[model samples]
Target: MLCGCVGLVWLYEGDVEVAVYLIWLALVFDFLDGFVARLLRVHSPMGKELDSLADLITFGVLPSFILYKMLQQQEVDAWVPYLAFLVAVFSAIRLAKFNIDENQQTVFIGLPTPANAIFISSLIFVDGSYPSLLSYPVLLIITILFSYLLVSPMELFALKFKDFGWKGNEVRFSFILFSALSLLFFLHLALPMIVMMYILLSFFVKIISTT
Candidate 1:
């Protein structure tokens, strides 16, 4: 919650990069919350619901706020900011879907909110060296696309390792290795690219598996 508060403040102050960094920290804490819960063998339905609430703030609202500010700066339209809120709305739906989804115990049926948040937050880099990426048209398309992805029924892979074997896990291993290479070579730009790669690779693997 503290991280969420700081992210809100930094975003309001127009320090978008710092706001994004805070979100990354929040993600770390988010992961640790589940890991710690499992370690202690304490599971509550309340805790599950509370975690979703927390995610709505950090992953959903924060990234949407980032887009809202960017839209204001770009002076696209008053309605564009409202369009940004769709991200939050769809993210909430995605969380709800995840809760009820038995198939998602091992994989996701849509873009995870955290991945969507990271992809959106990583765009602040465009504000610096790649300002072209912040054009009103591009941002609008991205806003619409990501909002759809949050709720789309496309299956996505989870990062969980089911076992030590590398045979059936080849796709997972490839994803990790390529993501690492992207970070090494592309730096911050690698983030959005990695998100795109994740979606594309999942689709490709699904097609191959079915065939």
Candidate 2:
């Protein structure tokens, strides 16, 4: 949470790239906290709530701050930057749903907050390679679309490694392999593409299992 606060400060001060990096660092810590807790068999309700709170700031608020800054940097209409907060609102809804939704054990019923954050940040990491993204109209559309995606009913596979065997871990393994290739080929742009690929691969897995 402290790191996220600092990142938010950096974002407002016009140090966007550093802010994005800090958010990513926060992600590493977030993952480790959960991992270490599970490794030690210490799952508590308080821990879960704390995780959500940290995520709300690191993944939810920080990403929106980045988007708001990017939009502002682009010199778009005044109203456009505020639309970025929609991401945080939807992320909160998604996190609350996850806490109560027993159905989402190994798979999520919408885009995960961290993935959405990475997707939004990765576009800016490209350093203005995609000029269309800077357009106010385009940013608004993306903001709304991502907000909806955060609460969508689509099943997205979680990247957790449940087993070492390939039989049940095929999707996770394939995703990692392809993600590596995507980064090799597309560089920073691959981060967003990998999120899109995650959705497509989930559908493919579902179809193949049914057939």
lDDT tens per residue, model 2, 19-122 = 88887888899889878987898998888888888888988999998888777867766887888999999999999998889998889998889888888888
For candidate 1, write residues 120-163 as lDDT tens digits.
99988857778976898888899999989988988888887768
Q: Find the 10 residues in a row with the least total lDDT in model 1.
A: 73-82
Instruction: Identify the runs in model 1 with alpha carbons over 4 angstroms from their true place.
Output: none
Kindly report which residue stretches of model 2 are placed more than 4 angstroms away from their true locations once superposed: 207-211
Q: How many clashes (backbone N, Cα, C below 3 Å) per candidate?
A: 0, 0
Return the TM-score for each candidate structure. Answer: 0.94, 0.92
Best by TM-score: 1
Q: Where does candidate 2 clash, by residue pair? A: none
- The lDDT per prediction is 0.88, 0.85
